[model samples]
Target: MLIFSVLAAAIAPGVALLAYFYWKDRYDTEPLSMVVKMFLTGVLIVLPIMIVQRGLMIWLGESPFAFSFIVSAGVEEFFKWFVLYHIIYNHTEFDEPYDGIVYATAVSLGFATLENVMYAFGEPATFGTLLVRALLPVSGHALFGVFMGYFMGRAKFQEGRKMRFFLWISFLFPFFWHGLYDFIMQSVPRSWIWLIVPFMFLLWYRGIRYVNRANSVSPFRLLKREEEVKS
Candidate 1:
């Protein structure tokens, strides 16, 4: 019962967060099965990501920036972006901009959920600790997903130079932010821990914008509006 409770606590935030993004798709939503599959794929990739990060850590030594940027942010974001591009980018279900946010958040929260479970079990375990993880690390991944999905959505729906530009930023934008986020957490002293709150707020602000923007530009939104006018 105790173990079950801990597991639930750890997983709840990820589920709730995925639901939040999924909810934001007011017009057309991705199929539930595919979104869940993306989440599971995110969960499965964690092992390989850990293996790669471990090797990078061993090779790079203790340089905080290298580990945070190259190992943590680079490997993780690339894999997530790779998965998004190769598998879902061209899929028929990914018909609109908002679907990108929904799917990307699904993948990210999947990764965050499994990572959270491991962290919970590894540590001494407390409500406060779990709560902190929910607010920061887990939510951070979801926000990164928002950025990634937003750009990928743009890229999918665009053409020529604009499409290429969005594709590049789809990976780069999240890479930079995720790297910086990891760097701050790893380097900043506990005395300065209060700084993270403001940073998190910034992420939240930008993430919300991404969500709104994606939804606004969704082809389905215009289609829905046109249908309403015809009615």
Candidate 2:
């Protein structure tokens, strides 16, 4: 059916991206149930994010900067960070650095997937439209998750000033990145659409670097090496 095709097109990118991050956790994977729970929590927050953004738009006026930075990016990223901080940050399954990437990406992709489906159903979306959405918005969300998770991973095993710093960076870095991304997409002229591709690639490169960094310092990886040496 046409509807099924549309749904598949809309959901595939987010799911694929999530799977990629999940796979990147080469040591000490989180329980599947916890990741799914985080994802569903993300889906549930979309309505609340919309409600808050709507109120902010009315109050702040729909200027491009305010909408992009505050109403949209600020609200969405904050909610995502909140779910991570409150739920997964201190949980037992968050035992390794890479687990941060897995959980954060799960939540972000869930939010992105539902958003994609809504956008697709809102109008007659074409293959091109869905592809663009996948490459840009959905992937963008995943990248933001990468940034957040990378810092939170560091913060988890740190102490005192270091812990606080990484914790704030986890939220702030994603907020700024998300805001800048939205501003460019919403404010740029049609002729400047070409700018988006390069920016996206830059984000993707940085995200992968973060993933690598997180995995490199994983306690499980280090422990495995130590055991092999002892044997």
Candidate 3:
């Protein structure tokens, strides 16, 4: 009973978050099946990579501090991006600019869910820890997903030099954000924890703006044009 409760508490928040984002981008939401598949892809890829990374860190006789940021932020972000590029980048569902953020969020949330479950099982079994992990760390994964999606969307839908630049910037944005967040929490004074709140707010704000901008066309107009062409 206790273990089941812990698993439920851990899994709920991340799944809920992924749902919220999927709902928000109603314009060009991919099929639920595809989202689930992409998410599973993230989990499968990360599991082994994390093991290898941990092994390499231990082999080098490095302190946890020596590699935590790089492993947590750099390596994780790279794998997420790689999975997005390889699996979903050229799919037919990636039709609109906003699709990028949606798919990215799906993958990130998948990784966060499994990680949260492990933490919930391993740590001191308590509601508070579950709450914090759900609210902060899990949400952090979604924010990183938003960052990756924005650029990937731009790269795919937008054209010319500016779009190309956005693509590159998008690729780096999640990595930098993930690294900075982990670094501050690990090394900074407790007083500085407040700083992450505003940063998180900024990420959410930017993510919403990016999606809205990408889908600026009126739905009715688009539908009419398609119908006219079909007729």
Candidate 4:
């Protein structure tokens, strides 16, 4: 029973984050099959990179700060973004700006799910620890994706000199955010722990606004455009 509870807490955040994206993307969402495939791609890509990073760090006698922030966060986020760009950048599914968020969120959640599983396995104090991890760290992954997707979509769809700038920002923003989040949580003293919660909440709040703005288009007009294209 105790173990089962642990697993539930571990799995719930990833599942809930994925569900939230699915719900938000109801109208212009990709098929479940594609979403799953993209997500799996993220997991497969990040896991290996993380493993090798840890190995190299151990060999070099490197500090966790260097490994976690510079190598792990930078490399992992880049690969995840690369996978999303490769798979869906030119696909028909990426019609709107918000589609970037949907796909990126899928990949991030995939990575988060596996990461959570590993953390949960090692964690001894089940309930309280699990709850805090789920709300903050796990959900932080989703918000990171939201930041990535927002800019990538803009870069792909928006047409202007500013679009390139936006694209650059989109790519770098998540990487910075992910790195900082990890760095702060890992390196900061326990006395400053209260700051982490609010910081993550700000990221979440920003993600929500991005999603709302992305989805602010008229469903009727989008349907009409589809019908016209079909005809």
| Maximum-TM-score candidate | 1
lDDT of 2 by residue, 1-231 (tens): 999999999999988998888888877777888988988988999999999998999999969899889998899999999999999998988998888888889899999999999999999899999998999999999999999999998999899999999999999999999999998988886844688889999999999999999989887897888888999
Q: Give per-residue CA lDDT, model 1, range 129-157, as digits (tens).
A: 99999999999999999999999999999
Alpha-carbon deviation at 140 in model 2, angstroms: 0.1
What residue pairs are clashing in model 2? Answer: none
Worst 10 residues of 3 by lDDT: 60-69
The digit string of per-residue lDDT tens for model 4 on 95-212 reads: 8777888889889888887888778897565678878878877788899999998888778866788787877787789988888887787777675478887888789889998888
Alpha-carbon shift of residue 216 in model 4 (angstroms): 2.1
Q: What tens digits encode model 3's per-residue C-alpha lDDT throughout 1-231?
A: 888898899889878988888887645567999988977876687687678678767665554454545667767888888889888888988887777878898889899988888888777868988887876789989989988987887787667997778767767899888877776677765665588778777877876787677566424448767877999
- Which candidate number maximizes lDDT? 1
Clashing pairs in 1: none
Ranking by lDDT: 1, 2, 4, 3
Error of 1 at 105 (Å): 0.7
Deviation of model 1 at 24, angstroms: 0.4
- Kindly indicate the candidate among 2 and 3 with the higher lDDT: 2
Give per-residue lDDT, candidate 3, residue 14. 79
Q: For every candidate structure, what is the RMSD over all alpha carbons to the true structure, in angstroms? A: 1.2, 1.4, 3.4, 3.6
